[model samples]
Target: MQGRKVAAVVAAVGALAFVVLAVLLVPWDPVPGGPLHPPPASSVFTTDQIDRAEDFAGLQRIWSWSSLAVSLAVACVLGFSRLGAAFVDRVRGPWWWRAVVAVLALTLAGRVATLPFAVLLRRRVLAYGLSHQEWGAYAVDLAKGVAVEVVGTSIGIVVLVGVARRWPRAWPAVAGVLVAGLVMLGSFVYPLLVEPLFNDFESLPDGPLRTQVLALADEEGVHVDDVLVTDASRRTTTLNAYVSGYGSSRRVVVYDNLLDGGSSVDDREVLSVVAHELGHARHDDVLIGSLLGAAGALMGVGLLGLVLGRRGSGPADPRTVPRVLALVALASLLASPVQNGISRQIETRADVDALEATGDPEAFVELQRDLALTSLADPTPYAWSHFWFGSHPTTLQRIALARRFEE
Candidate 1:
């Protein structure tokens, strides 16, 4: 009992430390003292545009939420009941092998259970002319996604079970460090190993746009391997760009659709997008985020240790994996607000950096508006939904920030 209490204390302390570090590092006020009076949605968008956006957004929100609900319900049923334990126990293997098999089975089951909603969501996107993916391609992508999830979940569960089996008493502290380290390592390698599986990439040709992008990278004092374009149009028409990985693996990736003939993005707007990504690179936001995530993982491991202690078993027993997975799902849902809040602020800082890098706010604003129009993003989302789930600043908030630079 005392040991369980200690694990609980460790969890509490780890959580507090994560919050403190996030506060210290996150750019909470990215647009400092920049007066912001966002124009009404109707002021910028016409009745038709607003109506279209609202309709699409409403349906998207519904399907997305329905999928999430189904996933969580599955998790709860498996975790909070004896059925999950019995299901995993039926697998015949060595303890670690059983753990691995259990994770694969459970993860695949959850994915299958929610697959209908996923199909519906995809169909809706197709209806709206957002996704170009055919049923065959979508199935292939879905399989890849399920494979990735299975591999990741298996690794984590196996590690947890093995460590707990080896060190019953002190596994909290040990697993905490181990989980944190794995988070950092995963962040470093994921871009290299996992991302290529989904998208095909080609370096931007030695053209004026590529040259300007290189110059922008130099101006921002960020080192990147190359500016590459990805065939994202194969999946969706969304204009997007990102920076991923760190050190040698770091690079800027732009969606090919961003440069397509039909795109509203001009060279300047593209620069704005690249500059925003560069801002993340400039501040090493990935490293910062990795650190935060590592901290959160450590805290989660501590709490999980306490939960397993209460259950009188840890991951070493294959049956416990389902319960663990369920708890993890619940924890993730609970932690979303803090995770999303920090993300929004980090994205805001990147936006501010874009404005500074280009010294062109009107182009940035235009880019934001066009992106919203393209995605059919609701200009003003429900307050609760935005607070809980909004990762980046709302499109209007971004435009408003750019407008601040106009002054």
Candidate 2:
């Protein structure tokens, strides 16, 4: 018993070490002097625009929150109830196979339970002119998402149980390291293996825009393999661009919507967008994030082991998979604030990078306004909600920062 607790403590300490390393390594304050003071939302948006955005964001919040609640409930009910165990018991298979089946069954159940919420969100988006995806297309995307979850989660669960079965006494420490490795592996390959399952990509054709993008990457010292464009406009109307992967695999992706939709998005705006992503790449932000995630995964798995052993659940038992999943779901929810805080800081630094890289404060600020109006983002959300769920600076705050940077 003491040994199990010690294992958990060791993993926790390791995670703490990684956290400290991250703190020391990351440039948390990319902008010198102090935090930028954002102008009032009214300064940038009209009363009518604010009212409409508030209305839209408020309703969107309700749907999203309801979905999250129902999904958590589904996880807890299956995990705490005998239903999940009973389903596993009915299956005749080796322990490994049963473990895989148990994970899939519970994951599918949770997803199916939350499906209605998904439909509601989709309908709302369609009505709001945010999405034009057909019902069949939506279903296809949803199924693809489920398949990815099943495969990914199944592999991790199998590893967790396998190591536990082999080294019951020290499995917490072993599984912590193993799960952490999996986290890094997943993050690294996600851009390659999983991304294509959803969208098709084509290289940005030879043009002044593409040439300038390449030049910008060169200036930022970000090794972008290709400036590719995604068929994102087929589903949604949001303007976005991003960089994913690192090393030789790194590439910049811009949404066709951002390029072709509104006259508001000009070459400079697009450059500003890609520059933001390049900030992520140049700083190895994804690498940093993956490192942090790896540490978190290790910490979570150690805690899971401590809980499982304390409950006398067999480490390798298929019956315990649901409980394992439930705990993960809870841990994720509880970690949101801390995770989002870090993300917001990282995103802010990226914004700073975009400003410095482009030296186009006017373009950056206008692009932000366009993005906010396009997405119906609330310029100023509740303090508590922003702390908990906001992963990026509010649009108004971003505009203010660009203004400050220009000064």
Candidate 3:
């Protein structure tokens, strides 16, 4: 029996690794690249546009499907009966509702905790100024982001368990919608309402900085309704700026820290940053990320159906449903590094776009180094770690690319 157990563990590990490798390596080059590629021409971004892109869409699809399948298999293969009993005990509700609540509460808690940090970072940039804050506020923001993710994920487990018990028949569908909602809120609503909570934002002071920012936008043919500067100094010191919103929601935000950090960044430098932010806004990265999440969830459900259907048994105990969901959620978390890698690649493209818009390689390099140091980002990171876990490429990488463009 002991030997058999060991074998099972090995098998499980092997299967999980296989799925991960498949996902990471599969060719999924959906986005196209080129200087001439018209903006808003396509929803999918291309690699030629990105600094370092992977053609792994096929792998992404396979990994996604296999991951869900394996997650379900693991729950049962490891000890489905045990997990089911635990689920029922923890969430005594009709079963399905309990799981739903568990998932929502767990997930929401994570979001809520990190929200304060994003708020603080913005506040510091606006009030104290980014150049002087020493990254104290930004640190908190980063911490909060982690806290939200951890706590929110915990709550989600409980909610999933409750859901299975309360509404076994429709639990999957309901869970999908809820998960989708969280993704939307986190990606969209939080950047607007939640972001301002920790910072003070107002229209840019009537000055050359404001005028130049707008003029550059016009030169690039990027339309903007307004430019706003936040008082990030009130909280801590870290200079930064980003473009937020989508289509109608679009706007450019600059932190007060950005202004005080430099004597002059030139119109072209500001334009570079603005252009980078615009890349995100124009590509609707927020919406696309959410949609990807929704797609992942749906795929998870389909995989679950395939497994459960094969066994000829619907969850015998509604409580087990949560455990099943938990399995998938866990798998997703494990795959986060891959997702981060994809995001980093996309960000690199945005950087390139920013450079192209301004034609100021020197400014872009300066901005990159300044931002890196301001954020205390390590200039050189382990290649594997960066590829798997880091969301943004290392400072050195960015500087190198900037120099490449400068020449």
Clashes (backbone N, CA, C under 3 Å), per candidate, total 0, 0, 68
Q: Model 1: runs farther than 4 Å from truth?
A: none
lDDT of 1 by residue, 143-200 (tens): 9988988888888888888888898777777778888888888889988898999999
lDDT of 2 at 10: 55
| Top-TM-score structure, candidate number | 1
The local lDDT score (0 to 100) that residue 35 gets in candidate 2 is: 78
Order candidates by TM-score, high to low. 1, 2, 3
RMSD of candidate 2 to the truth, in angstroms, is: 1.5
Candidate 2: regions farther than 4 A off: none
Q: Which scores better on lDDT, 1 or 3? A: 1
Candidate 2, residues 43-124, lDDT tens digits: the string is 9999999998898888788888998898899888888899888888999989889988988888788888888878888888
